[model samples]
Target: MTRIKNLADLHKIKEEVQSKNRLRSSLDYPEHLVQIKVGMATCGIASGAKETMKYLNDELEQQAIDAVVTKTGCLGYCYAEPTIEVTLPGKEPVVFGYVDKAKVVEIIDVYIKRGEQVEGIIPLNFQTIDD
Candidate 1:
């Protein structure tokens, strides 16, 4: 981590973090924004879900994508730890497994940006209450 050499530098870092948090937690008209749910359960964390979540959050902001990246529970896909469920506006949510840095980039570029499908998607067999 970079050392905070002065109070101004510390404030700058804090503001940066706050900006990212606001973007990730934004819920206004959520139906119009891309919704990314990262599995953060124990199994998921063990598989490096924290890194996955951080990368997703940072990349989305850097790309200026209007998205909300939130954390969820197990998602019932223990075999596919570090999984993420992405819901594009006006579409059904799709869960992808084994998400790493490269997968996150592909997901943002191909799936999220261009609305194209990528591999590693875990087919949803169960329906949610909303369905």
Candidate 2:
């Protein structure tokens, strides 16, 4: 964490946090929330899952998007490390690969906010044994 060097810096951080709080509280409807699952396996972490997770947490709250973000285990896409699955309200889940800060923004802005598709989508090629 960055240290607050002076009163000015402290106040700046306070304002930033307060603004985020206002945005976070705006999304009260649970039924319409977007669900996000981040893969945190060895490959995922090595490919920058931690940074991606942090970015999602902070940025999603800051944007006031109604999202339920959670950490998940290996998504069985070891080659496509740092993956995230996003399920929009009343829609099928879409797994995105090579997730980073930029991809997260695109997912939120294009996929979640605009209800449109974004790049980096990993298509479903195989089915589970249960199926």
Give one clash count per candidate, in the order shown: 0, 0
Candidate 2 lDDT over 1-131, as tens digits, reads 88889999999999997765444434453345677899998889999999999999999999987678889999799888799998875677899998889998888889889988788899988889999
| Candidate 2, residue 9: how far the Cα is off, in Å | 52
lDDT of 1 by residue, 70-96 (tens): 899998899988999998866778999
Clashing pairs in 2: none
Q: Kindly report which residue stretches of model 2 are placed more than 4 angstroms away from their true locations once superposed.
A: 1-30
TM-score for candidate 1: 0.74
Alpha-carbon lDDT of model 1? 0.88
The candidate that achieves the highest lDDT relative to the unseen native structure: 1
- In model 2, the worst 10-residue window by lDDT is 21-30
Each model's lDDT comes to 0.88, 0.85
| Least accurate 10 contiguous residues by lDDT in model 1 | 22-31
